[model samples]
Every structure is written in structure tokens, then in C-alpha cells.
Target: MFSNAVKCRQIHLIATSIAHYWPLLHERPLSTLTTTAISQEPSMFVTSSIFIILYCGLSLMLCWCDYQSGLLPDRFTCPLLWVGLLYHLYLSESTLSSAVWGAIAGYVSFATIYWLYRGLRGYEGIGYGDVKFLAALGAWHGWSVLPQLVLIATILACVTLGIKIIAGRKRQVLYNPLPFGPFLAAAGLWCGWQTLISPPP
Candidate 1:
């Protein structure tokens, strides 16, 4: 329910914070930096830690909001997508073209499935928010990681559904709408973290 102006302000703050702190996060040799270095340069270490904490915190907020409200506001998803693109652009870890294509492919793939499902079933089977969330993830990780990301998310969601049905002890549980955002967020976080530690070639 945030106003557009408020959302813009928030995104600006986040972008500025990242621009200020991100270089410190990568300033050290991640593979070689040790406890001695961390103790010597606590400010740099703490700033880098804060950046990741904020990143994960924002993602968790999105997951919680989606689960509770069944809505993924453009405020959160748009910033996520744009920040990811900017991250790669600033770091040059991946081509801008790759990130752009990843975003497009992610959005289009899910959007197509969403429409097809609605067309055949006469009702929405997938939320538009999920499409946006996936696109944000793609912007962070690129298209190559999407298949595995989706597969992991699907399995987690299915397992959760199965557990729900069993706990309820009812076959009718299949009709209930389950939120998929949490699973997607979990998978996205894992994939993103992996890429951060060991970037793709």
C-alpha cells in the first residue's frame, strides 16, 4: 500500500546505500581474507556484512508480504530487478545483455504459462507477482540458473503442499491455494548466494 513517491524514496535510499557500501564488500580477497584482516578492518567487514543482511532481509520481507497478502507490490519487485541489473553493471561480473535477456526470458516464460493456464481453466492459476519475482531473480542470477532454480522451487512447493494435505488428513486439500513465493524466494536466495561465492563463467 505504499505510495509511488514513498516507494521511489525507498528505492533511492537502497541504491545509494549499495553504491556506497558495495565496493567495500568486494574490496578484500574473499578467498584469502582471514580473521586477522577482519579484526584489523572491522569497518569494512561490518559494512559488507550489513549489505548482505539487508539484502536477505528485504527478500524475507517480500516473502512474508506475499504469503500474508498474496500480493507482490511493484515497489519491492521492481527495485529488486533494477538493483540486480545495477549490481552486475557496477561490478561487471556479467554482461548487461545477459541480465537483460534473463529478465525478459523469466517474465515471458511465466507470463505465458499464466495466460495459458487462465485461458484453459478460466481462472488465474499463477499470480503476476510470481512472474515479477522470478524476473528479479533472473536479473540477479541470469537465465542459465533458472531451470535449476525453478526445479528446486517446484519441489519445495510440492513438498509443502503434500505436508499440508497430510496434516489436514483430507483429500480436498488440493483445492486450497498455496503461496509459491516463499519457495521461490528460498531457491532464489540459494542460487544468488552460490553465484556470489563462485561466479559463473
Candidate 2:
């Protein structure tokens, strides 16, 4: 009788333990849910992060070169242009038609301004490299970001020129040929980040 009573108590304890743990066992874990979310959209996050890093690094390199030599070489700009086109082709983030048009529009618009300014002033206002840089950016981010790039670059360039003018009387001349590459490159990177992080409607 005692053994039977003990068996009954043991069975009751087992049942109580299972009841206590049942809710936990059935519940979904936070970590599991997080993992599932990551799995669902892993490509977008991973590719975007990689592109950001690469784009920023490339911009920095261009800025440094321009700062040192007031020049933007074809070596860097050419690669940037090609890579952007290839990236879009492979990823389908944008149509090839859009990228081609963007590249053409970017180069032509800047070239038009450059030639017009040169015709009136008898000197080039912006370099060929600057035009190529814009073309590359447009190809990568599409024409949508071009306006933002131009606006940001213009504001930054104006601010920089203002500062140089203010400091010139007290100090040496800032630059004989002011380098617009850094400003353009910085603006392009910023606009690219903006587009990548929060795509337009």
C-alpha cells in the first residue's frame, strides 16, 4: 500500500513538472525569430553592407588623390564606372537601360556645363575627371540620385570656396587650382548611402 502511494506521488510530481514547463516548450524563442528574419532577407543586408564599405573606401581613395594632386585619374574613375555597370547587371537592382541612360546623362550634362563655362571664361571650370565621376555614380545609383548628388556637391563646394575666401587674407592662397573632386566624391558617397539605406518610392 505504501509503495503504491509513493508511485502515485511520483506520477503526480512528473505531471506537475511537465505542466510547469509546457508553456516554455511551446513558446518561440527570441533568438530563433531573429535568425529566421535574417535568413529571409540575408542577401539584401549582406550585399548592401559590402557595397557601402567598398563605395566609401573608393571615395576616400579618390578624395586623397585629388587632395594631393588636384587630379582625378582615369584609372580609378574607369574602374568605378565599369564596376557599377556590372553590379547592376548582376544584381538587377536597376535595369541596364536605366544605367546606360544615367551614365550618358551624367557625362553629357557636366560636359555641357564644362564647355559652356570654358567658352566664356577661356578656361575649364571643372575637370574631365569630375564628369566621369558623376557618370560612375549615376550608373551605380541610377539617375534618381543624380540631382541629390549635384545639390549636395554644389552646396559643399560653395561652402568650401567661401571658407577659402574668408581665410585667404590672413593665410597663403588655398589652392591655385581648387580641387572639386573631394567635394564631388564625398557627395556621391553620401547620396549612395542615402539611396541604399532608404530607397525612394
Candidate 3:
């Protein structure tokens, strides 16, 4: 009876050892699993840094072009619109339909104001290029951001124009056409930067 009991205890010990090491024999090492998991996710810091550099650089270039030439070329705005749409397509942060509607709303809103101002005042108040630029920005930021964009741009434009008049010391009212693209680009950049820096809830 004692001999049988000893044999049973020995068998139990062996079975316990096998169970503990079963994964070692059948599965990959823990280090490999860790490496694979790390590789799957992107670092938000790196992605945000790259986005800021590229987007802000592009904004500055557009600002310079508009300030100097009073034009936001199709070369810039068209690519901007396509890239925004593609970003939404791949990232899935926003729906493609939202972007399309945003673009249409941006263009139509500005065009309506432009035509109404022309009819009432007998001159163009804003350029067609500004309309396209706003549409591109809308595509990038979606329709929800358009109202804020316009409000910020308008406020800044008014403030800047006031400062310029004060600086020039012109007592009489001077109705000079100012390039609106820079204000729009600046407001767009501010919105983008805010979005990037804020943490997701």
C-alpha cells in the first residue's frame, strides 16, 4: 500500500510540471508578443508633431501668397481639399458625406454673401479665391467648424484693419481692399492646433 501511494505522488508531481511548462512548448515567447503589440499602435506624439509641421508650413505659404498676390491659387486650395477628404477617408474620424457637405456649405455661404454685397453695394466685397480657400478649410475641419472659422477670421480681420488705419494715422475713412486669405489661414491654423493639443475624452 505504501509503495502504491509513493508512485501516485510521483505521477502527480510530473503532471504538475508538464502543466506549468505547456505554454513554453506550444506558444511564442512573451517578448515576441510584447514587440508585436507595440508595433501595432502609433505614437500620438510623433504623429501630432508631423501633422503640425506639415500643416502649419502649408498655412504659412498660403498666407504669404495671398498677402503678396491677393490670390489663393487653385494649385493650393484644390490639393488641400483632396488631401482633407482623403485623410477623413482613411482615418475615419469624419464621414465622407460630412466633408462633401462642408465643402458645399463653405462655398455657397461665401458666394451668397459675395453676390448679396455686390447687389447692394454695387461692387465685389470678397474674392472668389477666398470662397475656395474657405471651402478647402471646411473640407479639412468639417461643417461644424465653419461658423467658428468665419467668426474668428472676421474678428481678426476687423481688428487688423483697425490697427492698420490707426497706424497710418488716416483720419478719413479709407475703404481699401485687404486680402482676407491670411485671416482665414490663421484662423484655420488656430483651430487645427487646438484640436491636436486637446486630449480625447
Candidate 4:
């Protein structure tokens, strides 16, 4: 079980790497980073589509890897994210650097939770892997996905916690070190879809 920071970090790295690889495998238009090969102009829908593809694919892979190996092998997510940064820079043709900020925001937010878990003695409450995984996820869509991600994570964590409490009927159940990466990844996917459908500011 992923009962430690190292395990959490490993999961994060794996999930991030999966997210980074998605665009490469998808054959996205190098120039537009959109859904179709059209004029150079960008459309939010196209961006959202690409993001969804990456998010979903990455989510499944990360979860599966966690289940089977119990190790999210760093050889994957970390370096792959750097590659994703370069890839996004080349494709989107924008100086805003969406990927870089997204990754940074994800790491900061997730890391904050990780530290909080440590401070509060809430191990098994969250993992370091959850943190890095968010880095890659945030790198995908940035802060826009964060609110929804938190909402989803909170909802799922509560539901699971309740179920866990019920399953054993123990007053002081030691929470198992389970994977939160997949849930957060799902939240990110749903959040990306929301961005696609919502009216722009």
C-alpha cells in the first residue's frame, strides 16, 4: 500500500508522465494544438478536447500502474513532464506558457496538502505522489481545473472515508494508504470538460 511520502511521490511522477505522453501519442496538430487542422487561430473547444484526451488516458494508466506495481516509477512522470513543457511550447505557439504555470500551481497546491498531512499526522490522508501528479495535471489545464479538482477530490475522499468507516465499524480505523491520484485525475478530466462548455469571462 502507498503508506508513505516516497510511494506518493512515485505515483505522482507516474501520473504526470502519462499526462505528458498523451499529446504525443494523439497526433495533435502541431501548429494549432486544436481538434482540427484549420487556420492558425485557436479555439477553446479544441484545446479542451486535447486536454480531455490527455487527462483520461493518463488517469487510467496511472491508476492501473499503481494497482499493479505499487510503485509509480519516477523514470516516467518527471522527465516526461519536462518533455511535455517543450512540446506545448512548440505547439501552442503562445508565450503565456500554460503548461509551466499549470505544473507549478499543481505542485504548490498538492505539496501544501502533503505538508499539511505530515504536520497534522494525517499520513494515509494524502501522499506526496498526489502532489507531483497534480503538477502534471495542473500543467495540463492550469488553475482552471483546480477548483473542480478539489471539489471532486473532497467529495470522493468523503464518500470513501464513510464507506471505509462503515466497512469495519471501528471507532479508530487506521486509514489505508490508498490511491487518490486516479480520483484527482478524474476531477481534472471533468474540470477540463467544464472549461470547454462554460462561457468565457
Worst 10 residues of 3 by lDDT: 192-201
As for TM-score, the candidate ahead, 1 or 4, is: 1
Deviation from truth (RMSD, Å), model 1? 20.8
The superposed Cα distance between candidate 1 and the true structure at residue 152, in angstroms, equals 0.5
Candidate 2: tens digits of C-alpha lDDT, residues 136-191: 87877778778888899899988877787897632433337668889888888787
Regarding lDDT, does 2 or 4 come out ahead?
2
Give the Cα error of residue 125 in candidate 4, in Å: 4.3
> What residue runs in model 1 are displaced by over 4 Å at the alpha carbon?
1-51, 169-175, 198-201
Using TM-score as the measure, the top candidate is 3
- Tell me the alpha-carbon RMSD of every candidate: 20.8, 7.5, 4.1, 25.3
If scored against the real structure, what TM-score would every candidate get?
0.71, 0.71, 0.75, 0.59
Clashing residue pairs found in predicted model 4: 8-129, 9-129, 17-77, 102-138, 102-139, 103-139
| Candidate 4 local lDDT, 1-201, one digit each (tens) | 557988999999999998999877766556445535344335555664564455466666776676565445454456435544644554453622666787888889878877887788855446666677778766655566666787897798678778878897445445335567667756766775654234233
Measured with C-alpha atoms, the lDDT of residue 39 in candidate 2 is 88
lDDT (C-alpha) at residue 61 in model 2: 78
Question: In model 1, what is the error at residue 4, expressed in angstroms?
Answer: 86
Give candidate 3's TM-score.
0.75
Best by lDDT: 1
lDDT of candidates 1 onward, in order:
0.79, 0.78, 0.78, 0.63
Q: lDDT for model 2, on a 0 to 1 scale?
A: 0.78
Which pairs of residues have clashing backbones in candidate 3? none
Per-residue lDDT for 1-201 in model 1, tens only? 469989999999999999999887887566356866667567644544554555576578889988898788888888888877775675555466777788888899999999999999999888999999889878877888889999999999889878877798456555657788888889988887776443334
